[model samples]
Every structure is written in C-alpha cells, then in structure tokens.
Target: MELRTLGYFVAVADAGSVSAAAAVVHVTQPAISRQLRQLETELGLELFTRGPGRLSLTAAGQQFLPHARDVLHRADEARAAARTYAAGRLERLTIAAPTTTLTDVIAPFLATLTDDDPMPTVFESDPREAYPALRHGADLAIVTEAPRSTLAARALASLPVWAYVRDDHPWHGRDAVALHELVDETVLALTPSFRPRQILDTALARLGVPLDRVVDCSNPQVAQALAAAGRGVAVVTDDARFGLWPVQIVGRDGPLRIDLFAAWEPEHHAAETLAALAARLGEFCVERYGPDVAPAGHVGQMGREY
Candidate 1:
C-alpha cells in the first residue's frame, strides 16, 4: 500500500511488462513484482494477472490506474511547491517540444526568460507522451496538432506547413509548384505516425496524385539532411530547418499548412505566462519565414527536374 508500490504498479502497467518497467524504474523485476503483489494483497484485490511471460492488468487495476496516477501527481506537486517556496526560486520549468520544431521555434521565447527565472529544461518526447506529461506536471508542451484529451491545457497556436527542398535541387529556384506536380517527384517522408506524413499522404490523396515515395526517415533531422543531399523533397516548418540544417523554400501549399502550439495546465502558477510565451514563439517563426522573404538565390532556380 506504499506510494512507491503504486508508482511501480503504474510503471509496470505502462511498460506492459515487469522487466521493462524495472529497467525504466531502475529496479529489479522481482522487486517490482513483489511490491505490486504486496499492494494487491493490502487492497484485497487482484491488481495484475501474471502468466509465464505475460503481465496484464486486472479489471481492478484498470479502474484504479487513473486514481493512482492522480495521487502520485498531487504528491509530487505538493513537494515541488514546498521546495519552491523554501528555495525562493520556481523549481526548474520542464517543457516538452516536438523534436522537429523545438529549437528554432520554441527556443527564442525561452531566450526571453530573465536571469532571475531559471531557464526551462527541455525534453524531446513523442507527442502522445508529451501531452500527458504536460497535463500531469510539465510546465509546457509544444505540438503540431491539438491533442484531443480534456486533461491537456489547450492549443496555443496553429502554424502552417511550408515546402522545403535542397539548395541544389531543380525546384529550389522556383517560387512555387503546383501541388499535384510534387507527386511525380521523389518524396522523402517521415514515418507514418508523424503528423507531417499524415498531412502529406492526405494532401496527395486529395490531389489524386500518386507519390513516388523514396526515402522514409523517422527523425526530422535525418530527413532534413536527406533533403539537403538532394535525395528527396520534404515539407516542414522553417523552425525545423534552424541553422544546422540547410534548406530552400520552393513554395507553400494550402493543404500542407500545420499549426504548432503550446499546451500547459491552467492551474499552474503562470498560465497567462505560457500564452505570452506561445505568442513570442509565433512571432519568431513569422520573422524568419513570413511572406516577405523571397527564396534565397543560391538555391536552385530551375523548375521541376522530372
């Protein structure tokens, strides 16, 4: 019935295996199992069903998971608040940013933080995971699409997608290309789980264009590098390009537009502060990729190569 037991139970449930949970929680499998069993015994209910190689939650466990998580979260919050009050410094703000958009998109607003406030600690995690963490405790989370769960704070901004190509690519010099024309060209895409991939697939479907899929990369950075190498073309935000990855904007597509936003708990110390932060992030993006900037000439000027 200890809090640590509930923590272990939640971890095991999430990992779907005692061994995996132990690895993540930094304990042995048997230890985690023992603690969970003890908690189950104290509660007079079967929390988990243990098989030869399977670990699954029982009905009671399924029903109790959310409550256990809330208890743990509230406990952590109380601890953090007490520490913050004593230390006279808001404990470090932990923010999650989409790996694809964090640096150039979200970092500038963070730069505005005064020396008195501790710099935010940034985490790059799956959007699915990041949203829940923000609702539970993370100070902020940046996402490409609005998450559906009511537990989350809310969407801060909606950003659109832009066409990105290699500097040396044939289309680099072009101001824009017909959306349907891109289907004939080699396309580098993110894994299907990524929002960009879903949007691209849907847009191509609507345009009645069959895409020539060439490279499939999970990491946006790798995809950007592939685009830079003239391997294929990808659509991404200017924030994703940053300074490290070189790219050229061939043009924009209406269907390719994406919104990038921040989500945070309203009950937190500075909910309004997060909104202001979101605005600054949006401004930074507009400054770099807004309508006024023409495509760089060093990039190719030719039309479609194919």
Candidate 2:
C-alpha cells in the first residue's frame, strides 16, 4: 500500500528476481522478499511466479505493472515540482517523443536552448503514448498525428515519405515510384502504430492495393537496414544520412508525406515556455526541410493544410 513498497515491486518486476531487485534498490534479499510478500498480501493477488532459478510475472503482476509505473512516475513528478518551487525557478520542461522524432526533430530543437533557460528533459516514448504523457505531466509531446484531445497543438514539420532501396535495386535511381508500382514488390514498412504506417495503409487501401507481403519494422533504421540487405523496399522519412536511394511515393495527386506535431495543454503553467519551444522546433524543421514546411497554424486553426 505504501509508495515505497510500490517502488520495490516495480524494481522486482523489472529485474525479474528478488535478489536482482534487492541489488538494484540497495536492500538485502530478505527485506525485499518480505516487502514483496506484504504487498501481495495486501493486494490479495499473486504478483510473480516462483521457481528455483527463474522469476516471471503472473497474469496479475503483468496487469498491475503499468499502474505501478504510473504511480511512481507521478510521485517523481510531485517531488520534482516541489524541488523546482523551492529553488524558485521555472519547472524544467519534460518533452516526450517517439524514437524517430526524438532523433529527427526533438534533438535538433533542444540544441537551440541557452544556459539561462532550464534544460528540458527528453525521453523517448511511443507516439501513441506521447499525448497521454503530456496530459499526465509532460510539458511537450511530439506526435505524428493530431492528438485526439483538445490540447493546444501545432504542426512542426511535414516530411515526404520515401521508398528506400539498395544501390543496385531497380528502383534505386528513380525519382518517384507510384504506390501501385510497389504493390507487386515486397515492402518494408514501419509498424502499424506509426503514423507513416497508418498513412501508407490508408493510401494503399483507398487505391485497392493489396499489401500482402510487407515486413513491419519497429524503427526506421531497421527498415532501412532491411532494405539495404535487399529484403524489400524500405518506406521511411527522407533522411539523407541513411545513405539509401530515396524514391518518392507518387500518388495521383502528388508525393505522399507525413506531418509531425507538438502538442501541449494551453492551461499548463508552462504554456508560454511550451509555445516558445514549439516555435523553435518549427523553425528547426523549416531549416532542415526548407521554408515550405513552416508551421501552418495551431492544430484546430488555419495551420498546415494537411
């Protein structure tokens, strides 16, 4: 029931063993084991499976893990808030972004911060989790799609999605490839949860193109690597450093593209700071992608046409 016990439980769950959890928490094995037993007794649910040399979560433990993590995260946020208030400085911004955006957008945006400004805390999170993290405590969230909430948001960048191929592949030297042209070829795509993947799927579905033999990758780097190995054509955002031939996806109208947004609550105490950071991020995207990608407007307003 205690916060300390929850922390101990999370450590045990993460480490997968009592002794390992004790090592991480700097507690003796017996103490950790006793605390875990007490926690299970209070909850009236078995959290872990016991074996001679193995420890694993039971169904109940697996179900409880996320809740425990949320509690710990909120506790940490409370402590941070108190400390920042005591120090009489603005609360340090915490920005959460998906892995791809963390590399392409957030990192570059952060490089512009000065010493007088509180250095923002950056964390890599799944795009689906970004908005929720913001609602919970994060100051800023970088997401691919517009958040479902009414949070204030703005388009940060729009990157053209490219089909990458091995140097010797037939499509390597092409300027563009139609979506249907890829229908007959094996495609390496980002995972379903990714915005690019959602866009690609929708486009293909609308065109009645069957995506029967696609390889799903969790990250762009993996997809690019598989394409380099000639496993298939990798679909990703155009990053010249990837060292692959970038072929545009030509639709009937034009090329396919994906937009990234920075979302934040307007009522948050850090609203002004968040807006400033968002503007800087927009500028960073414009510098990298070109002036055409300027932040259009606020999310529900007259901003980016897409």
Candidate 3:
C-alpha cells in the first residue's frame, strides 16, 4: 500500500469521519473515502464500519491503526530527513522545553553543535507540543513531565526552582520572603497550555498558596520582562532566574525544585546522535548549572491531588 494511503487511513481513524479527515487532510470527503477504500482493498480487511452517523474503526482497523500510524510517521520522518539532507542539513534537533530551560540548559549545550561541521538546525518548542513531535519523529525532547505509560524516554536530572522578579522589584531587594507571601504578590505566569502552569498549580495545591493575581503570558522572556519591570514575582528555575533577570531569589525556603528528563522514540534510527546530544547536554548542565540540576523540572507527584 502507498504511504499516502496509510496516512489517509490514519487521518480517518483519528478524525472518526471522512468529512473530518477530509478537512484535516485538505481533501474532499469522497477523496478521503476513496483512499480508505483503496487502502482496505489492498490490505484485504474492512478498516471501518459505515453507518448513518460517524465512522468507527472495525476490529481489523483497530489492529491496523497503530501500525499504520507508525508507518505514516516514519514516512513523514523520511521526507523531513531527505529534505534536510538534500539541503546539507544532516540533523534536525527539535527541543521541547520550557522557555527558561531552553535559555539555561539546551541553548548553552547547543554551542557544541554550532561549532561542529554540518551543524543541526535546532527547533525550539514548548513542552506541550514536544510530545506529539516525539511521536511523529522529533530528534529529542526535554520536558517537565512525561506522559503516562510512555516508555520512550529516560529520566535525566532534577533542578532547583527559584522565585525571581525584576531587579528593581521590592522582592528582589529582599534576600528572602515567606513562601506564603508569594500568594499575595502579583505574579507572571505562562499559559496553561505550557507545562509551567501545571507545575505552578501543583505547587500551589501542595503549599496551599492562593495564586490570585496572575498576569497570563505565553513566553518566558515576556514573563521575565514583566517581572523585571517590578510587576511581581515570577517563578522559574534557579539557572533560569540567573539567565533571565538580575533578580535575587527571595523565597524563605530558597526555591521549589523539580525533575527534568530527556525522552526519544526508542526505535528511532538516529539514536546515536540523539544519545550523544543528551550526554553532551547533561555535561553542559553540570559545567554551567551544576550536576544536581535536572534537565527539566518535575511537578506532578508532590501531593496526592496531583
């Protein structure tokens, strides 16, 4: 069967209807239906059940779905690899990390790749978007939390957390403040789509701090700027705080800490390069931020509620 046929089938399975799949694939419903029919015919199995309403995958389709997804994913990866190779780009390293981590951890580690021959083009993405890329074929990902039952990654390191503000902020002048006091302070926070928000929520629940005045923002640079302008305290990694602002750590307990990890597809072909990057990244972390630093912060398991 054609790779495109596999892709079409996977799209239909995910969307649960030809029209929906058509919309996703930017093709007409009949075209999608025809492709699915062709794929089923070639495979000698009924992949779906036709009904008055939306489509449902048959038992055969259910069995075929993962395999089809794997094939389609590999095909897409091959296309990306070929294009990159043709353009003299041997590797495409996609890092899914918190903005702070990108600045503090991976970005510094990337100095090695930059100085090397045929340097890889590094793509930065938020942790939330990173997992799907890994499933679809990202070279490597750094995340605060891994998905449940995901056996594709290795736990790397855990890093300390810090509450930072603009250098001119009141909190910055103070050497430290009670953790409870942060609840009353105006804070800059990342969007909920990002992992930091989940981490913040989890921490607040554990410490029972009321986060009432959050200024919602998307990027860490923006958040740090807001905090730098003396808006409020911004929570970030210790390394991230030092990298972003000239702010001092002002929490009485010092700062909250979290675990970070590196994950990749176990069956990926570029495992050697990916592993090399991971090792170099870890060594860079130790040199710059200390060996105790996590590649990303862990936040979910502090309390029973999380």
Question: What are the runs in model 3 whose C-alpha is more than 4 Å off?
Answer: 1-98, 114-118, 147-150, 167-170, 173-176, 238-254, 294-306
What root-mean-square deviation over C-alphas does model 1 reach? 16.7
Angstrom error of the Cα, residue 128, model 2: value is 2.1
lDDT of 1 by residue, 1-95 (tens): 67788899899999999999999999998898889878988989898898877689899899999999999999999998888756544547788
Q: lDDT tens string, model 2, 54-118?
A: 57899999999999999999999999988865664565788898887888777877787788777
Best by TM-score: 2
Task: Provide the overall lDDT of each model, using Cα atoms, as 2-decimal numbers.
Answer: 0.66, 0.81, 0.66
Clashing pairs in 2: 296-303, 297-303
In the order shown, the candidates' Cα RMSDs to the true structure are: 16.7, 14.2, 15.5
* Most lDDT-accurate candidate: 2
Question: How do all the candidates rank in terms of TM-score, highest first?
Answer: 2, 1, 3
What's the lDDT for residue 158 in model 2?
Answer: 75
Model 2, residue 213: what's the lDDT?
87
Off by over 4 Å in 2: 1-91, 295-306
Per-residue accuracy of model 3 over 1-306 as CA lDDT, tens digit each: 888778788888888888888889898888878888888888999989999758999999999999988887888889988886555443546666666777777667767666453354456777667778777656677777744444355555656545676555556555455667767788777777766566666667767667779888877667776776767767655354333343323233445555666776655665545555666666676677666564444223311011
lDDT: worst 10-residue window of model 2: 297-306
